[model samples]
Target: MHPATATPTHCPYCALQCGMNLAPGRGESPLAVEERADFPVNRGALCGKGRTAPALLSSRVRLTEPLIRSHATGRLEPATWEEALDTVAEGLDRNRRAHGADAVAVFGGGGLTNEKAYALGKFARVALGTSQIDYNGRFCMSSAAAAHQRAFGLDRGLPFPLADVPRTGCVILVGSNLAETMPPALRYLTELKENGGTLIVVDPRRTRTAEQADLHLAPRPGTDLALALGLLHLVVAEGRTDEEFIAGRTTGWPAARAAAMAHWPEHVERVTGIPVPKLREAVRMFCAPESAMVLTARGPEQQSKGTDTVGAWINLCLATGRAGRPLSGYGCLTGQGNGQGGREHGQKADQLPGYRKLTDPAARAHVAEVWGVDPDTLPGPGRSAYELLDALGTDTGPRALLLMGSNPVVSAPRAGHVEERLRALDFLAVADVVLSETAAMADVVLPVTQWAEETGTTTNLEGRVLLRRRALTPPPGVRSDLDVLHGLAARLGPGQGHPDLEKKFPTDPAEVFAELGRASAGGPADYAGIDYGRIAREDGVFWPCPTPGHPGTPRLFLDRFATEDGRARFVPVEHRAAGEEADAAYPLLLTTGRVVAQYQSGAQTRRVDELNAAAPGPFVEVHPRLAESLGAVEGQPLAVVSRRGRAVAPARITDTIRADTVFMPFHWPGEGRANTLTNPALDPVSRMPEFKVCAVRVETVDAAGRDTTPSTGAETADAAA
Candidate 1:
């Protein structure tokens, strides 16, 4: 049966936005989820998360009513949707009148579909006229996006589709563990490996991806820029660069070479811990191959020096003449399924749809005309997520905050500080499908539709765009995020916001998507050929799909760059230490990451009995020597404390990681929130905190089975706002 006539059409779990066919046979027959072949990127493969999606769609914990905390009684009560929205609208207006437009801020999520993302951006800038608006993508891809713009005058995550992977002769997998994170996308990597293509992996730990590589380089965290510079140093010093490619396709080679000379293999070996010999071998392998791809992900991009590190990696590709050609370029593997699309549709602080910068006069004029508003009326780039929270306790901070599909109290870098800020907010609203840890503390909770109940578009790690079809009606009382925002905008009056705002806001998502396409036109991420009709009729296509009859570009910079000189520019890099280093008092380094069985912050996966059973609780992996010294044994409780806060979890003895470091998953919060112990120091360029490195002390806890870590959700919700 066709999906439109079926019960559900969307994947329940991931924001990947892939399409599916749901077949229900009888009253009692279980529904089967088959991959919809028309889906662009996935084609038909489903990850473990995707396979378990349906259960999430039917979860009992989903919110289906409007909730408000009465100011008079100090109690939460169910209210009609109109009553709840009226309360929010009044509160926003009151706050705006008292504290001015900058006092209010909106925080969006990468999980929202393209249509919802564009709407959120427009609502914040046009409807509310607030400059303090940003999204969770600031934490995920800001650095990579900035790097792309700096290098190629564009911000296409991969600049090519996933189909190009199989054609590459060499693939450099840096700081990304695709084998565990997205198992279904591994076909191309596995095929390339089987066909004798060289696989080089670089990371701080021996991840599933690293262990399978022909060569694995375990550099110290945050020293990736140094390593990249060193590799380029070798490439240039030994005269192994593509001289013809460099001369014709790049600029600043001489200066970059001079900077590289200062970071020879021997110099970088001291910082990265990669031996000179091994580094040389990896460099030789990468440069010798005719077709090569360099990719980085969460690790390098989630650091204090993230953007510079990304720029250095791109510099390596430029020096080697590997980009703008089929199957070769510097690619960043995004963590969220829709991370690419979220940034593309103007959800970012400094951008408009189509990856156009907010600062670009022409781009701003185009969007302004499309929305019938003054270009100068839109706010400039805003503070990033970490900075936004930091601004909360200060006089310069935003007083009222609207959080949509994000749980910063649990997921942000500093849990204690975030909680403090949330409490201090003059007004706070949380829009989510479920009652998350952050939602529990909200003054008002809006029931928003989940993926299976919404329709729109999403782009994958590659630049490919695909449609998200609605399968079931949203649960009673729940609405799409766009609809919720529109309702609130209408109640606030002149939802278009400024004196120049158009007469009304578009209710049709297709119209909103069309505006987004036009915003991207003539920009680096042009999608002029795509529309709702085209997407529905022709599966989906990758961008820069510029015009009709024009085939979408599979790769970028085939012959030249977008730079004024028609050449890519190289930026020199230097190695920097992690924000916090191990000291005598705090003698061990702590690093955090995700477990294959769970997703970020465990808002959804933790609710599933089967998934929770696979990894029931958080465990700290320590070297046997460290565990013994602390009188801790396997499954025994221990307290790991940093200067900021502490967490107590079961101990697991493992040598898979370096002896100097302890590994923990960032999924759990409350009593054992990794964020409590994580430092909040920011990288100057990207403003991303150092989640991968910190200093901590270990001690045994006598509490036995009683884990004292705070529960981030219901309990807090009951006690707080």
Candidate 2:
């Protein structure tokens, strides 16, 4: 039978933004994924996670009411929306009155819509007047964004569209496993190969994505910088360098060339463990093509020197005349749903709307004018994501935190410590669709609407802004995130001395978008010309659209770069050791990533039976040789210990990974949370933590029922439960 009328929209998972149709239909079949063949990004393709996303809307797993912790019983119980909002306002007010404005902190996420991110930032700066605000996107692509801005003077996840991927001559997939992370995107690589374009995958393990590459270089974890430098050296040595392009369109080539020349094939072979012959072959494969592109993801961007690491890769593109041309450039494979737009608006700590720097007086004045406040009243930039999380509840930190749409308990580096900081907070309020591990610890939990039940805009990895039209009505007692913010603003605004703050926080998504456009005008990520009508009509509008009649930009830097002189700048860099390295105490390197069946933090996906059955729990992937050396058998529990903490998970021995390295997926909580063993070493430029690599040790768990770690989603009882 043909389903009832449907709403054509995009998926709510990754940055690919795969288009799909949601059929609200009728009772017992309220949600369905139908065919949507028109959208260009994914061409109606959906992955397993997208196919199973409707399962998350079931009342059987999602929260349907507001919850407040009772003082007498000390347990979270159902409460009216008014009561929950009032309590949250009082908690935030009390904390602010006692300590200071900065005592009240706000934490946001990459999954939020453009309107919500903008409103959240305005709420922090205008309503509560606090500087302590940041989002999870900092962990996702800050390094790439930093590198992009430094080189091109602008930062978009991908400078060009995905449509160009199939036509490019060669693509160097750096540290991104698109085959497993976003299966629908892997088709781009497949199409590139079909077009006679060579594909090279660089990673520490032979992942499913690497299996499809013409050449796979499995370097030691944290040695991506050396690997990239070595390829550039070979390009120069082979006389493959585009001297004319470097001299005309780029600057700082001499210093960058000197840096690459210092790292010869033999020296890079010792650092990255890729052999001298493989380096020469990689250079030949990359330079032989008329046009090539370099793309990086979390693998190289989550290290201590992540910004410079990405910079090194961009140098290769500039040296070979690949950047700022047709079908060739440098891009970042953004991982989160709205990671590209999350920081582009105002959610990040150091940024204002339109990707403006908070430290810039002109930027502060522009955003402040839109906010209807004195520019001097605006607070300065605050701590980054990891730094903000580490400072909670301390004498030098905020006492109360309002966290929305993020679950740092499961996703943050050093999980146990972040949880401890959460517990130390005097007042904690969370707004989410489910009682996530982090939300379960909050004093008040506000149930919010999901993607299918909300109308908003999200900028995808291609810088295309797509509109997600609401298909189904939200369950009773639950409201959209905008409504939650509006209600809180009404109660907190007057007390914070703004009598009309509630008017600034609109419950309607379109109205919020209009205001966001004004705030984002004349900035890097200009959205002045784009509105709800334009976005809905155009399918998706690329950003920097300054006027209503102007067509959005699909490709950047084609004619000229976004710099002072329209020339890309190259910063000289050298390879350095990771924040930590495997020593005698920790003989193995541990790297963490995501699974195909689960999304970030596993908050909503873990509630789905199908996804859970597909990926029941987290486990450690060990090399066959390393497993045998540790006296571990397949499925045997093994305890992985680091300087911060210990986590135990069943072992799955495989030769896909390096013998000296092990792998874990960080989508779980408690004992199996790979983040528990991660280090919080911050990159000097990007402030991104070293989550991709850390030193660790493995030990066989005693089978005699001794102390053992609990599996994912099997945490101890909480007061709310």
Candidate 3:
């Protein structure tokens, strides 16, 4: 029973997946979290969010029983597990019967375990017979993933381990603020500096992470594409291009080089706000080293042209011959906890298990064989995350929805409109640990177990699959998401008038993982060789382990790229304007991101008193220039209006951000919901929403919506240091 004392587990917040131990708590707390030193990633350092994660386990804050919307009162009330499961099943079945199987949709999360993600995808295709399925992860790193696949012919967050950071020659960090988002991981960069490696941070804000960089490039929001192309331009002009490696290990260098040549230093300087001299310095630092790496996060990815932007960066790496070698290559700093594993399984709309393309006949046949179904019987590819959510309640869209582990109301771009779409759905069912803003609208809300109360596997950003053991039994009336899916699958499969459901989904995480492995065999993210026993024995096993005796691959592309010809493919791309630019009406750019004390959507962290004390609530981070123009003062409400929607939060005046941009933490709902102001314009390739940059106008106001001159003081400038 895990010794009834301490259970080693990984943090449930970000993709870093810091290791910790959960011991039995003395009083109301469910467990006490302690740092685990054996894990190579963090080395026993725990973030405040990880330390206070147990606070959400208390029944006083989270939902302890199933809730059903009453027909009479139009409000949610307590209900039995059986009743809630049956209600969800009937709701889904009724929608399918009326409008066909495509009328019912399923939305998943990035935090779910590998088993749950597999089962959830299976339940949607096999049990519900619907192709309308997607997940919130599309908002996290889809652009980087798309670009990674296009260039490397494979996508695993990082090609090497976090330990490689210290040994690299130079590391270019794009958009990610690891010091605040992933505090423990900041040590890797510190060690890099200690090891005499150079650090370049590219961000619009002079964040806590930017302060540590040897060189900081502050480009305008959504201008990352221009910045990347400009760097490549300088590389070509300075004759830093590795022609030998380009001819030996890469393809399509001619078109890529020619496209980069068009963007001169002066033109790029005009396009992006970065100076020409600073651009040359970044290129010199990057090319001076024998081996260097470029890592990107949400900054460059959450845009309408995210794929091409990431591709521009990859082009620079390939022109310099940094990829497919030790201490080098391009990598993505995925934000979700299991984002690596989540997309590897079938949760993504266009993918089957093992990162296989849904349209590929061989992939479909392999997975269908594992599921005991005909290959042609499975539905074709479906809509992307934002597309699926936008289509909800429409004539050609889904009428009923089943959601788990995500809070789209607070997280989705253009959140106000998303809420309207949710309200229009014929039936909605949500399963989460707490009654998130999205869960509050569900006709049936299922209380699911949290991280400490469950046993599962999560693949970190390093593509290392680790196990999280159950530290304690969940409170009464709470069940795991897999169990809920299993119960609903039984009710909705081959019963009443509906038939065709032939597969049985197991509730046990281990059994589900075994099935997932079998289904994923021979695919890009092959996991056939990994098992629970091996994970415990190895601490964590890297993917593409096709057999029991074959050692897991830690550093991919060391020998050859995953492409058919064993050479990296370079696709030519040019920088373009943002989906929405700063217009006269909305003369400022608005960007959204996370805070240290609050995780995504603030569903769990907002409930923790400690985390709340550290970050009381959402606020608009306005630069001194913008604040002076708007007469905004700290601690007073400031309204941000966009073409999509309007939101307000207390102004936090600081000079850390760009003069033409404002920052907001997207963890709260109501007036402070940053997603409400974000643009839903998606990338043509990745379908990632433009969450990072959108045009908005800010005005000083009171806590109420009424405009007013905020109280003037000393012009507070305290933000992330």
What would the TM-score be for candidate 3 when compared with the true structure? 0.97
lDDT of 1 by residue, 334-391 (tens): 7776888888877777788777779989989988887777899888988877888778
Model 1 off-target regions past 4 Å? 1-19, 25-31, 37-40, 494-503, 704-721
Summarize candidate 3's per-residue lDDT along 60-141 as a digit string, tens digits: 8999999999999999999999999999999999999999999999999999999999999988888887899999999999
Clash pairs (backbone) in predicted model 3? none
- Write the residue-wise lDDT of candidate 2 on 571-610 in tens digits: 8999999999876677678899998999999998898888
Q: What TM-scores do the predictions have?
A: 0.93, 0.97, 0.97
Q: How far off is residue 295 in model 1, in Å?
A: 0.7
What TM-score would you give candidate 1 relative to the actual structure? 0.93
Check candidate 1 and list the clashing pairs. Answer: 9-471, 304-683, 324-556, 324-557, 670-710, 671-709, 671-710
How many clashing pairs in candidate 2? 0
Model 3 global lDDT (CA atoms, 0 to 1): 0.90
Q: Which stretches of candidate 2 lie over 4 Å from their true place?
A: 1-4, 25-29, 704-721
> Sorted by TM-score, highest first, which candidate order results?
3, 2, 1
**RMSD to native for every prediction?**
5.5, 4.9, 2.9
Which residue pairs come into collision in candidate 2? none
Residue 540 miss distance in model 3 (angstroms):
0.3
Cα lDDT for residue 290, candidate 1: 85
